[model samples]
Target chain A: MKQYKHHTLSVLVENKAGVLSRIAGLFARRGFNIYSLAVAPTDDQKFSQITIVVDVQSAPLEQITKQLFKLINVVKISELDPATSCEYELILAKINAPGNNRASIIELVQLFGGKIVDIGISQLTVMLADSPTKVDDFEALLEPYGIIEVQRTGRVALAKQETSSAKLRSISGKVS
Target chain B: MELTGAQALIKSLEAQGVEVIFGIPGGAILPVYDPLIDSPLRHILVRHEQGAGHMAEGYAHVSGRPGVAMVTSGPAATNIVTALADAYMDSIPMVCITGQVALGSIGTDAFQEADTTGITMSVTKHNWLVTSAQDIPRIIKEAFHVATTGRPGPVLVDIPKDVSNQLMQWYWPDEVDMPGYKPTVKGHPKMIKQAAKLILEAKKPVIYAGGGIIRAGASDQLKTLAELISSPVATTLMGRGCFPDEHELAMGMPGMHGTYTAVTAIQKADLLIALGVRFDDRVTGKISSFAPNAKVIHVDIDPAELGKVRHPEVPIVGDVGYVLTELIKEIKNLEKKQDQSDKSAWLKQIKDWQIRFPLTYDKEQTKVIKPQFVVETLSANTPEDTIVVSGVGQHQMFATQYWKFNRPNQWVNSGGLGTMGFAIPAAIGAKVANPSAMVWAIDGDGCFQMTAQELVTASSEKIPIKVAILNNAYLGMVRQWQEMFYEERYSEVYLSPDLPDYVKWAEAMGCVGFRVESPDEVAIVIEKANAINDRPVVIDFRTDSSEKVYPMVPSGASNDDIVVDPSQGQGGM
Candidate 1:
C-alpha cells in the first residue's frame, strides 16, 4: 500500500443538489482526510465529475473508493494512477516586480509556461495551470520577487489517453 | 390523477407497501397530515421524534422491511437524528420523511425552517430535498429503495411545505434505476470455493457472526454451514439471536461483555469465518492483537466492510445469505463429509472453559431481587417466541445474557450506538410488527427514565408491550467503570429511585404499574405482567446497583486478558 501513493480519485456523480455535500459528509463522518477536491458539471448536464485527492496517510484508498461507491449519486469511481494520469493545479500569484527585477520574473514565468494576467507598476499578477509539481517549482522560482498574495485551486485530474491500457483495479485489497 | 404532493407522498407510501408509520406531525408537515387522515397508512403518533425513529427501527429489525418514520422540519428532524444514526450504525432499513419550510423560505430561516437534508447528510445513507412537486413520486421511490437495499440504512426525504400542497400529476415510477447502487448479492464462485477450502481444512475455526445474518435472513444457511463444518459460532452483541444459544456449536456472544468461552475461542482459533461483522473495537479489544493466529474469511453486503478492520484472506463482498448458501454448496462439492472427531480437541478445550467460567450470580443469598434473576424468570415465564427488547446498560447485557434465543430477530437492542432509551419504543414497534407475539422491554432505571413517556403512546394505542424496569437507581455501567478505572469516585451516577415514583408515573400514563423488592416477588410479578393483554404494563423491580457485568475485556486490552467474575477466583480469571 505504501507504493501506491497517488490518492486522486475521478468520481462521476449525478448533478443533483446536495451531491457534493453527501460526498464531503461521508469523508467527515468516516474521518477520511480529503486534501483536495474539485467539482464541475460534465457535458451531459445531468452528471458531474468530482476529482478528489485524499490524504493517504489518514485513510486507505480502497475504503475511500468503496465508501464513495455507496453514494447513490456516484456513477463511477476511477483511482487515477500518477504515472498514467494527467493532473494539474492552477495558481494565481501577485508577485512584486519592480523595473529592476521585472525582466527576470517575466523570463522565469515564461520558462514555467505561466502568463502575467495583470501588470501594475510594482507587481505582476501571474497565473499558471500545470501539474502540481510544476506549479510548486514556479511558485518557488518567483519567491525572491516577494509574492504579495497567492491563490491555488484544488487539483483536477483525468487518466492519460492511449497509455497502453493498464488495469485500473488496485491490487492492494482482495476485491473478489 | 392530479393530486397535491402531500397526497402523492401518502399514496406512494401505500404503493410501497408501508402499512404503518411512526411519527409526529407539526407546522411544516400539517398539509401532509391532512391527506394522511384518509390514507390507508396507520400512523402511530409518538411522544418524541426519536421514539418514532426507533420504533421504525424496531419494526424493521423484526420484519426485515424498511421502517418508515416522518417528522416535521427544524427541531423535529433534529430530534430523530439519534435514531437515524442508530439505524445507520446497525444497518436497519428505515425511511424517514421530513417536512421542510416553503421553498422560498428554505434558506431565509423561516419559522421551523432547517437545512434538514444538509444536517442529516452524514447520519443518513442517502437523502433528498424535493425541489419540485413533480419529483415526489420518483424521489419517494428512490428513498425506500436506497433505505431497504444493499446494506440497508436510514434514508431521509425532505419535502418543503409548499411542495406538499402544490398540485401535480400523480405517477409512480415503474422501476428503480440507480445504476451506481447495484449491491452484489452473490459471492464470487472462486472466493466461495476458497472459503470452503479454508473452513474444511482448519482444525479450529470460529464463525464470528453479526447482525447481517438476521438482516439477510441467512440463519438457516448459517446453521447449515456451522453444522456441516462443525465450527463454533460466536454471535456479536448485534448478532445476538442469529445463532441459537442452545445449539452445540454456539459460542454465545463475543465482545467486551462476551462469555469466557466465546472470547477465548476466537483468540485460539486458526481460521475466523466472520460473516456480516465489522471487527468493532468492543468486539476486538486491541485490533493489533485480535485473532492473531486466525486467517479471516469475511462476508458482507457492504464491500467497504471487507478489509476495513481485520483484513480477510478471502473477502467475499455479497449478501451473507447468498455467500453462506454458496459456501455450503462449495463445501459439499469439495468434501465428502465432516467427522465430528476432527474438531473434538477444540470442542473439549471450549467445554473446559465454559464449565470453569459459566455465567453465574449469587441469587441464593441476596435479599433483594437480582437483575439477572429477573431476566431469567422473565425469559422462563414469557412465550418462546417473545421478542425481548433492551436498552443500553448493564440490564441490556443481562437481558441478552440470560435469554435463550433459538431463532433470529427474537432479541432487539441498540448495539452500535448504544442508545439508552431504545427498548420501550422499539418494543412497541416490535409488537406492532407481530401483534400476536409477546413483546417485553427490559430496561435499566437510567434507561427507562429516558423514554418512559412513550408508555403513554403505547397505552393510548393499546400496544400492550410489557416493560420491566430494573431499578438499581444508579447508572450501573458508568458506576462499574468509575469503580474499576476511576477509583470508586462516583460522579453523578446515582438517581434517586423513589423521587420519580415510577409506579405512579406509570399510572399517570394510563398503564398498570407495580413495584417489587423481595426475590420471592420476582416470579409472581413476572407472571402478572405476562397476563396483561388490554394495555401496556410496567414492573419496577428494585435491583442491587452494585452488581456488574462480568467477563469484561477492560477496554482495549486483549481478549486473552478477560476479567471473569470476581467470585470465580484466579484473580477474576
Candidate 2:
C-alpha cells in the first residue's frame, strides 16, 4: 500500500515564453495532481521560480522529480521539507456582513491576524496571509458569515536557510 | 564576417556535419532555401513535409546522427507533427527547422503562419522560437545538441522569415551555455558494482534490451555482458537489432505478439536486467503481475523511466553504453562465476520452451502467399547488412519477427508511436544515409497506401529503395482484432485489391512494380525487385487476409493469458 502525500517542490527554470505551460503539461501528462502552483520572477532576470505542490502516491516522487528535470527550461529543483521550510498561502474572502454580522466578522478577522481590506455597504472583504492550515481554519471560522466570494494565491515556500551542501553527492567521493 | 541569418544557418548546419536535408520549399522558408542553393549541403525535395520528417528519422535510424528536415510555416509545420511525435515516441534524434511568419506579424495570422513552437512543444524533446537573427547559429547548435543527447528525440527550431532574412555577424558559439540541459552519462561506480553482483548471484537472469542500446551504440557491450553472464536476451520491438537474432542466447522480441520462448522467459525470470528500456504498458501487460517474482535492475539514461512503471530494485541512471561498459568491467574484476549447476538447469528450461513453442505458421496449407512467408523470403534474399524498415501493422510485426537482424541499426520502425505511414519516407532516408547498403521497406497494404506518394520523391531523387507490400485485402491487424474481440464484425477494414492497382501506381511513380499472388512466385518476384538497383521498386505480395498475428496477449491481459492461436480452444497457458 502506497501512502499519498503532499510534496512541495521549488523549480528554477529559464525565463522564457511557454516554459510554464511546458511544466504544467508535463504534470498533467504524467497524472501528477497539483494541489497548488505559484510562479514568479526570481532575482535573476534570466530565471523564474515555480513552487508546485503535488499530491502523489509515494512511488511516483522519484519519477516526478526526474520528469521535471527532463524539461529543457528547468534548471534546478529543490524539494522543500515541511520541517525546514517556510510555507505561506494568501486568501481573500468577501463576507455578506449585514450590520450586526460585520462586528463579529471583523472581530474574528483580527483574532486570526487578518485584515478587513475592503468595506462595502453589505459586505466586508477580509485578507489573510498565513500557513495553509491557518488559512483553512480562518476560512472555516468565517463560513457562517455567508461568504460571497473567495480567492486564493496558491502556496509559496522557501527553505529557512540555505544548506551549504552539494545538491548531489558522489558515492565514491570523486567530484563528477 | 557579416552574413544573412539564412547564410549563418546554412554554415552552422555545415559545421554540424549535416550531409543532406529532406524537405520541401514554400513561401516563408524561401529565404532559407535561397541560401541553401549555394550551400554544400544536398537538399532532397520531398512530396510532403511529413515525408521529409520521416526521411530524417530513417536517416537518423541508420546513421546514428541527428537527421535534419526543413519546412515552411503553417500547414507544412503542422503536417510534420505526426513524424515529430513518432520520433519522440521512438527516441530518434532529429532536428526540424520550420520557417515562421515574420516577428512583426507572428500573432496576427500572417500569410503562411502558425505557432510552430507552441504546436510542437509537447511533441518534441525541446523547441525554440528564434526572435533574433543573431541567435540563429547558437540555436541551431543547441537544437542539434539537444536532439542527439540523453534520451534522444526530435527538436524543432522555428525561425521567423525576417530573422532568416536579417543580416547578422557569423560566429559559432564557443560552447552551448544551456545550464539546464546537462545529461548524466556515467553511472555511479557503486551502483555499477551492485548491478554486477546482482547479475552474478541471480539464477535465472534475463537481459531485456531496448532501443537505448541502439541509440547509445552499446550493442557490443550488451552482447559481451550477456555472453559473460550467460543470460538469455529478449529484445523489445524498439531494441530489435540491438542483439543479434542468430545468437544462441537471443530470444526474439518479447511482449504482445512476442515469441513464446521470449515472453515466457521474461515471465519466469528470477532477475531482469533491463537496459535502456522503459517497461511500457504494451510490454508489461498487467503491471502488478509482470515479472512478479523478479527483481529488476533498470538501467536507462532517463531517470524518469526508472520508477515510472515498475519500481526497479537497482535504478542506475546513465548512458546505456557507459553503464554497461563499467558494469562489465566491475563483473570482470569481481571474478565471480555463476553456479554452473543451477545456471545450466535454467538454460535447459529455456531451451525446452524455445523448442516446444517456436514461432510457427501454416505455410503449406494457404494457397495465397502468407504475409510472414513474404517477409521470410525477403529476409532470405536480402544481404546480411540490409536495413529493413516498416510501417505500423501486421507487416511490421511480420518483418520484426521474420527478418534476421545480425547488426545494430538494421531494423527501423515506429515502435512506440506505431505510425501507419512510416515505411516509404523512412526507407528513402535510410537509403540516402547509406547509399551502398540495401534498404527494404516491408509494409502492409493499409500502411503502404497512407504515405506511398513519397515513392515519387524517391524516384526523382534516385534513391533506389525496394518496398515489399503485403497486400492483404483488409486492414489485417485491425481485422484480426475485430475478429477475436469484436465478434468478427469486420467493420470498415476492407481495402479492395483492384481499386488503386499498386503496380500501376508504382509505374506511374517512375519505378518498377511487381505483384506476386502465389507462394511459389514470392521468392522470384522479390529477386526481380532486388535486381533493380537503378530506381525504387515496389513488389505487391497479395497475401492471405484471414491470417492473424498470434501469440498476442490481448491488451491489458497478463502475459500468462497469451493467445497463441485463436482457433484453438483458449490458447495455452
Candidate 3:
C-alpha cells in the first residue's frame, strides 16, 4: 500500500488547561503523525476545535476520535473532507521601500487592498488578507520593490456551516 | 508596541523556547547582533556560517527541537545553503536568519548584498524577506511555526540591514493566521484498510523505517507494530537506533553499504512495507532490480514522496507512525500466520553467504592496517546509545557495517545527498544536544580534510565528541573503482602528504588526540576517548588504503548479484 497523504481532521477538545498539549501528546505517542494542526475556540458552548492534516491511509478515524475523547477535556472529534468543505488561509508581508520608491510601493499596496500598518524612514509595513495563494501572489508583486522581511501563518480552517464537524465519517466498509 | 524589530525577533524566539543560537557576526547583521548580545539567548560564534547551520541541524536532530542559525548577508548567507539543503532533505527542523543589505542599496549591486531569498527558496520549505519592522514579531513567530510543523524542513528569513536597524513597536500575538500552508494529519480509512489487507495476504513481509519515525516521535508505535506483526524491520542509516538493534525482527540498515543479511532479506521479501522512508538510492539500489518480487507498500507524511521513486502497490500518504498503528490494529484482528514456519531456506542462504564472507579483519596480521578492525573496535567500545555520525566513503561504510546501533536517532550521516565534511560539525551538534550520549564522528582521510576546520568549533563548544579518523592513506572507495574498472591505473587518487597526526591536530585545537597504529591499541585508545567527557578528542587510526567494503551490489545491480567477498576472488568484469 502506498502511503496516504492529505487527511482532514476535526478534534473536539477540552476548552481548559493543557488540552492542546494533551491532544498533541496523543498524536505524538500514537504515532498518528499529523502534518498540519490548527486549534482554536469554537463558536459553540465552551468547546475547542482542532483541525489536523494527517498523512494516513484508509483507517479508522473513530478510534482516533474515541481516543481523543478519552482525554477529560476532549469532548468530541471528527475528520473532515476538504473536498466537501471550504478551506481558507490568511497571510501578511512587510515591504521595504527605498527612499525614492514610496509612491510606487503605495500604489502597489492599494492594488491588493492591503493597508500600511507601519511606516518608517526606510521601511513600509504592508498587510494583506486573502487565501495563501493570494498572499504568495502579493508577495511576488512586492519582490521587485525589495522585501525586507516576511512572516506567514500556515492554513487554518473550520467545518462547513450547519453541519456538525464533530461527527465521524464512515469509512469504505472494508474494516468490517 | 515598544519593542524594536530585532528585539521582537528575540521575543518571538524566546516564545518558541529557543535557548541557543549559532552564528557568525558580520557588518550587515550588526543591528540584529547588537540586540542578540544583550538578549538571554546564548549565541555560539562559529568560524564559518556553514558550520553554524549544520550545528543547528545537529542540535535539532538530537534534541527534536527546531535549531536556529543566524548570519549576515552575501557570502555568509550563501555558506549556510549546504546545511539548509541537508536539513531540508533529512526533514530536520531549522530556522536560518540572514541580514541583507539596506533597502536602498538592495538590487543596486550593494556591497555585501545577495539575493538570499531567491537563492534559498528552492532549498527551504518557505522563506520570508521582511520589509517593515512592524511585521517582525509576527513573521518570526510564523517562521518557527512553518519550520516545525508538518513534514519539518528548514525555513529562511532575510532581514534587510535597514529593517533590522528600524525602530518600530512589536506586538506578540497570542495567535496568527495563515491560509496557504495546511499540512494533513489524519489517515484515510480506505488506504489504511488496503495496507492492512496487503499485510494479511503477504507471506513474507518487512517494514522499513526512516528518519520520520524519530521526527514524529513514534519510535514506540513502530516497535509495537513490528512486534504485533511478527515481521522483520530494517532501517535506513538515518533510521538506525530508532528501532532497538537487538529486536528479533530488527535487520539493521540495507543498501550499498548495508548489512549483508538485511539486504538479502529485503531482496527475498514478497511484501515490503516502508514507513516514513523516501526510496533513497542508497536504500534502493537500481530501482528496477530492487525487490522485483515484493509488493511495495509505502507510507510517508509528504505526498511528494509517495510514488517519486518505485511505484507502490499501495501508497498510503500519511504519517509513518499513524499508518503503522492502523495496520497493526487490522493485522491483530485476523492474526493470520502465513509463514510461521521459519524460512530456513532463506535464513540458511543468508547464513552461507555470511560464512563465505564473514565481516572480518586479520588480528595477527603484520603489515597493513585494516579499516574493518578500527570500525569493529570502535563499535565494541562505543555504547549502543552513542550516536555515530559518518562522512561518505570507505570509513562511512565501515562504520555502518561495524557499529551496532540499537537506539533510534543515534546514527546521523548525509545519505540522500552524500555530502562530505558532514560528520565533524554534526557530531558537535549531537554532542550539544545529548550531553550524556557518546558521539563518535567517523571520518575518512579525504572527507575529514574537507571540513577539518570545524574542529575549532567542536573545541570551542566543549562538546567533547570523539572523532575517529579512519586514516587509510588513499581514497579507498575511489581506488577500488579504479582497480575494478580502470585496471588499477591509480589516477589522481593519491594524497602523498603525510597524514597530519590528527592526535596533535586535536591538541592544536586545545583538545586531546590519540593515534592507534596497531589493532590491539584500537580498543584501549577508543575506550580512553570514551572515558573523557569534558572536551572533544580525535583518534587517527592508521588503516590500510586498499581495503574495500564487500557484499557489493554495484550501483544498478540486483541483490542476487551481490559480491560477498571481493578481496578473495580475482578481479573480473
Clashing pairs in 2: none
Give Cα-based local distance difference scores for all models: 0.91, 0.90, 0.77
lDDT of 1 by residue, B166-275 (tens): 99998989998886778889898889988888888899999999999999999999999999988999998888889999998997999899999899899989999999
Give the CA lDDT, 0 to 100, for residue A1 in model 3: 35
Q: How well does model 3 score by local distance difference test? A: 0.77
User: Number of clashing residue pairs in every model?
Assistant: 0, 0, 56
- Write the residue-wise lDDT of candidate 3 on B352-426 in tens digits: 644555555555675666888877777877776788889888888888777777766778887666778888877
User: Model 2: per-residue lDDT, tens digit, B289-381?
Assistant: 898889999999988888788988888989999999999888888764544325888899999988777777886765788888888888998
Q: Candidate 3, residues A59-98: lDDT per residue as tens digits?
A: 3454455445434355555566665555655556667787
Candidate number that wins on DockQ, 1 or 2: 1
Instruction: Give the higher-TM-score candidate: 1 or 3.
Output: 1
Docking class of 1: medium
Model-by-model DockQ, in order: 0.74, 0.50, 0.02
